[model samples]
Target: MAKDFHPPYPWQTGLWQQLRHDRQQLGHALLLYGRAGIGKYAFARYLSQALLCKQPHSGHPCGECASCHWFNEESHPDFRLLSPEQAAESDDESAPSKKTKKKTQISVSQIRDLNEFLSLSSHRNDGARIVLIQPAEALNAASANALLKMLEEPAPDVIFILVANQLQRLLPTIISRCQKVSMPAPSESQALAWLSEQGVQNAQQQLAYASGSPIQVVNEQAQLTTLADIWQQLALGSKLQPHLAASMLIAHSAETGIIALQKWLCDLLTMRLTKQVHYHIGQSGALQGLSDKVNLSQLMQLQKKVDELRKLALHPLNHELQLEALLVEYTRVFVNK
Candidate 1:
């Protein structure tokens, strides 16, 4: 569903221009892929809305038109958004289930349901129909196969925009049917300038912490206090209590807490070997302290384990216990010399 349709970030200007330049020869499906948190989804939404708008200006939507109003209100007949959560919500709304478990994939049924929409003509004369599937890697095997059929015989007047952060996860057949657009990530200076414009303090720290993603910096700012507390507990190293630290860490989410530890461990591993600190330059002293005391072999193993856990973070597992076990292992990696 469409949220507040803020224009794409400033760094996306070049890519935006490129998309507009090729508007006439656009394919039935466009695959927009790039780094996470770099505003790929937002760009796709903007482009889709622009294409559906009755009065598009220079490849962007004319914000005042009735079509644009319908788009902003998430009621545009010609536009459909297919994401895991959105698909589940629609099912729940119609089926009236008792708080069904959240879905994680673009299900086969969701893709099959598109047939009904594809059979209908556009609501307006000469208006282009659009379907935007965000994080396209969320398509499971069956769903991907169903979608592959659509791509093979694309319905007229419909444009499918598949946005993905992890392109490697997509099927080769699926990727081949679409026109691929490689989204750009802003440089450090560009990202910092944008963060400055947003009046975000400590932009440099947030930028590095977010791996140069400005959107990530903005999102993480909301949880800075929690992150700082987690970092402090991590800085305790061998002294950190696994149960206590896990309690604080799980206050956010298992994924958040694991990512924090993974970052810290990454820096610890790197600093131990390369004398380089990446994500937590602000906590270089803490990282360096842990790096000196941590067992190199054990640290490497734990890093791998933590990385693996991140992939399974969305599973309905006991996250607090998992985190506690990880933290206990984290403490073991450090020992009194």
Candidate 2:
């Protein structure tokens, strides 16, 4: 049986019931919009499985069925998942000698290829077809336009489920065509409870760092140690070694390192201005000590640079060097002891 063949998250129970009960009222295109790392993609997947299940029980997928098996195996004939990574895979089959940059946009060609799939009838005569576009914001202008045409004249019994974290990035026409479903974010209590159920340690602290997203906390478990080390180095303020810190910071990826820096900077600002830390709840003492020494204007300037670096994290640039420069700047932002 498939691992993902389970029910929706506990917090999503109500919404799931409502959606399942009103399945007939759902539009051909469903826009599931919400904050990232809040299980929106998981919800979409569960819904898709349920829709394609041959033996759906009480509006849920029966894990024992052939359709469920196919879906779990990612070989369902009636289902297609359109994502930037998927588009990249289809476009680049040749093995690259060097480390190639990952693709970030769904190309127009990926959208155009769907025409043949849309024209074909479902594998099961009476079953429905599903096209799931995750992080729909990844659809570039050309691809978005191509998708719009399909949405305007959708195929018979075909459901287009678009999942998005940033809803504002999507075109207005696309938003208007679909039935928007506002996926709920779990409350702090709900999130903590879920984390506890999963046997995650330091749930409250992790939850705060993840911006209350339970899913993100779970996903970032392995990086917790690295993040803690980064925080300790950051707390060193003016005495921090830029070169050594830069190597450790970008150990995972340039983006991850940048985000960690951004969050640390955010907490520093919060601590400096309001005497309260948001993300780094457990680092209050360290933040307070550093915040007092931090030059506000200099910190803000470094924050802007970090933001810019994060935006260009995917580009083929010397991230380690850039990060090292930023850490050096970070050191300069604090007064000498």
Candidate 3:
């Protein structure tokens, strides 16, 4: 319905094209699984538009049509979307806080709200009623079970598109009810080329740091500009300096920030393995020194450690304690260096 519907990325176009065709014949429900920020949300939206479009071109929706305009304005009564609340109100905003509030998970209430919204007949009376639920795993057991019931007996001409970052977290019954579509990460070279084309001066460096995610690299470049100083200390294996740096980094950005730092470590290790001297996104003189200090085995171990920590981040853990433990463990791994 939106006139400004951005097309899927070049890599994602084929998948969307396929989904468009499926919608033409009227698919009931779909589960779209992909890593975050890979345009899963956008793709779901594109599909929703195609289904509701009164004047579609082949399988694609005509953006210029009236239905498309309503969709774009987010006024289409048939269209619904649900996502986790971004930030909760802090108790003490006036005082300096050490930690921010976590993004709350989607609960049974949201799903219940959706059930009520969809139970009624379509507002438009004829087009498909579309619902897009992102990071659907944020649902608690009660919420998930509620969704399961709806999927089992979906209304006629209704579509449910569930997007998830971690498919494994979903119940098997939930996954089995809908068609599964995998959104693979782009190839390393393809991601790097996209970054470079976007005028990233150090495309090689950034791509290596990002680990095949252009958005992650670009986002880190903008958000973690201070990481350079912290990384420099870590590269030199300055024990005291790294602890301080880690503290500062953790203090500034929580789980997501640490995830980016883990990406940096992975990139350095990747370069170490391949003996590639350049970074795709940005310059980092410390990479070479760090590579020399840590062997391939050590780097691989650290990479695994990072992954373990990232998985824990998805849960309702104590952020402060988790970060402190993570930093301490990170230091202990390369203490010999």
Instruction: Report, for every candidate in turn, its global Cα lDDT versus the true structure.
Output: 0.87, 0.90, 0.69
Which parts of model 1 are misplaced by more than 4 Å?
1-5, 90-102
Query: Estimated TM-score per prediction?
Result: 0.90, 0.94, 0.72
Candidate 1 — which pairs collide?
none
| Worst-scoring 10-residue span by lDDT in model 2 | 1-10
lDDT of 3 at 318: 64
Q: Candidate 1 lDDT, tens digit per residue, 162-235?
A: 99999899999999999999988888898888888777887887787888888887766777546777889999
Best by TM-score: 2
For model 2 the local lDDT of residue 295 reads: 91
Give the residue spans of candidate 2 off by over 4 A.
1-7, 94-99
A best-first ranking of the candidates according to their TM-score comes to: 2, 1, 3
Could you report the Cα RMSD, in angstroms, for every candidate shown? 3.0, 2.3, 5.8
Query: What is the TM-score (0 to 1) of candidate 1?
Result: 0.90
